[model samples]
Target: MPSKLSEEISPFYVMEVLERAKEIEASGGSVIHFEVGMPDFSTPAVICEAAVRAIREGDTRYTHSLGILELREAISEDYENTYGVKVSPGNVIVTMGSSPALFLSMLALLDPGDEIIITDPHYACYPQLIKIAGGVPRTVRVYEEEGYQIDAGRLRKAITKRTKAVLINSPGNPTGTLLGPDVIRDVASLGVPVISDEIYHGLVYGGEAKTILEFTENAIAVNGFSKLYSMPGWRLGYLIVPEEFVRPLQKLQQNLFISPNPFVQRAGVAAIKHGKREALGMVGEFDRRRRAMLEGLRELGFVLGTEPLGAFYVFVNASGISPDSHALAFDILENAHVAVTPGIDFGQGGEGYLRFSYAASVSDIEEGMSRLGKYLDERKNKSR
Candidate 1:
């Protein structure tokens, strides 16, 4: 057997849901998508123009293993301005989205037997990434009762001497909860290095999202242009590593990725410098959809946590309808023609919930919610 057959990593189940939705659509069924976390908008005109100019001006070649100096500088300056954290351009490593930066962070930080503590109800990819980087993923259960924030005491209990770091995602996927700055500070006081995924930072609906840099210097901040800038296909993101991790991460970048695409990096520069208005506009749209979905789901008797302050998702409790979220999700897809993510995709503690992304247009979200409402109503009648 091939070595690929011997490994047992779990698949990203929400993506499978998306694939099934696509199959249904190809067969002439209308599938309203709330499963995938992609924005339903085009890249900003400024970013597109910059990429075109870069390519025409012969900026297509690989510039540096760490990325073009100008793009890195822009990212550094953006961080400084946004969070009051001064990061040298040398500490920024531009990668092909936050995914590669995550891989590199794990590789640079963890050894084979090391453990990484992450919250339950985390982004689906976190544990898989830890496993691939040769580390054990230790999960601390976070409840919807607490707005899905990790309990500091429980998290501290999960940390062992072998633990290398704590992984946290604010404006987190599936749950859509933003970690409080005080929680971040408490976690950092443990003296463990923290890896904060702040990809959804600029998409908040209420209070501002805190960058880990504002709370701790012993953190790696992972951010990308995809979510906030509506530049998913651009595959451009950067990491802000502590001064000490800079050289090691750069070496990893040199060997693993060489660099993110040069033209895309130029587009990233345009995004940071001139695309704020366009990006913020998308957040406003998502905010409207978020309110719509929350109201609709509540009418369907789906209990929710406190409204999310950031991110474009609503994580709802479906235990009343079905404790098995996977089955409930499929029921919605098959009967309601609306696709959603089962909480199991996130982690163990997520088993009784469902995640609905409001990154689509208002019409699609409203239609999907209507379908869901009808389906759940019929299910209740049937049970009665």
Candidate 2:
């Protein structure tokens, strides 16, 4: 039998949808995928060339468990230039990816039975990672009616003596909503530690999302080269933690992962320095696709409560058509050939919605919408 931890964790329905899509493709049918948060773009050549240069220079051996000083320094300068936060290189801890950075930080800060306050319709992995670290997730549901924004008052009410941390994701997964600067500041001022996941930092379309470091030095700024650089396969990320937590997080990382790949870190340095032009370009293209998906879904009768300000997803309310989002997603995949993520995959608050990723090309988005329109029209006609 699997461990209790693994057994209790819920499965990712997105992956299940992907598997079905793959089966359809394998049977010679085409599938336009929107089920997972994956980018369709390849890593820019500039970043790839850096890896080649590193291989030629034989920079393949292990470095400090924290990371190579040069890369950490690059990350430090980046935060200073981008967020106006003068983070010391000593505060940055590089790991295999932001996933481990979050996991290790959870271990560093949370005791067994301790609690973490997470916003609802959150990244599916957040609560599971907290539970795996022996922490209970205290979720505060942010409704679609509120643009999925965090309400300072509700967040304050959720805190307790057991609340060890508040995990905040800006330009968040699923909803693509940004927490207002005031909301972020108010939460930081509550005196609890904050894990600010800025993985989608550079992908904003309609508004700016601030790094928590702008408000307080006590938050952990977790970000990576994945979303912005389109380098998900690189598996490299960094954590900016408070001075006190650095040693403990380093030890946790030392035991789990000695360091991120040497070649990957070498490429990460190039991505930080030279990849911005291309990264910003992707954001514009994503904006175009976002408009296409936004207008198309709304025209098809999927009610989006808010304009997505950042990230690549549209968290749409599908309750007007059906309350069972899980079944609705598969229904569209089987009939329309467009796969979307079921809202329930996010949490209880997501039960009657669907998350559509606009990471595909504009043409693909148009074609998927065309197929979706037909499917929904048929459903409407049959109901009559």
The deviation in Å at residue 176 for candidate 2 is 0.6
Give me the overall lDDT of model 2: 0.90
lDDT of 2 by residue, 69-159 (tens): 9899999999999888899999999988899888988999899999999999899999999999999999999988888888888989999
Tens-digit lDDT string for candidate 1 (1-384): 545623678888888889889989999999999998999899999999999999999987877888899999999999889988888999898999998888899999999989999988888999989988989999998888888777789988998999999999888887888888788788888889999898999988887788888878889999999999998888888889888888899888888777789999999999999999999888888888888888888887776768887888898888888999999898888888899999999888888889899887888878888888788789989999
Worst 10 residues of 2 by lDDT: 297-306
**Cα deviation of 371 in candidate 2 (Å)?**
0.7
Q: After superposition, how far is residue 238 of candidate 1 from its true place, in Å?
A: 1.1
lDDT of candidates 1 onward, in order: 0.88, 0.90
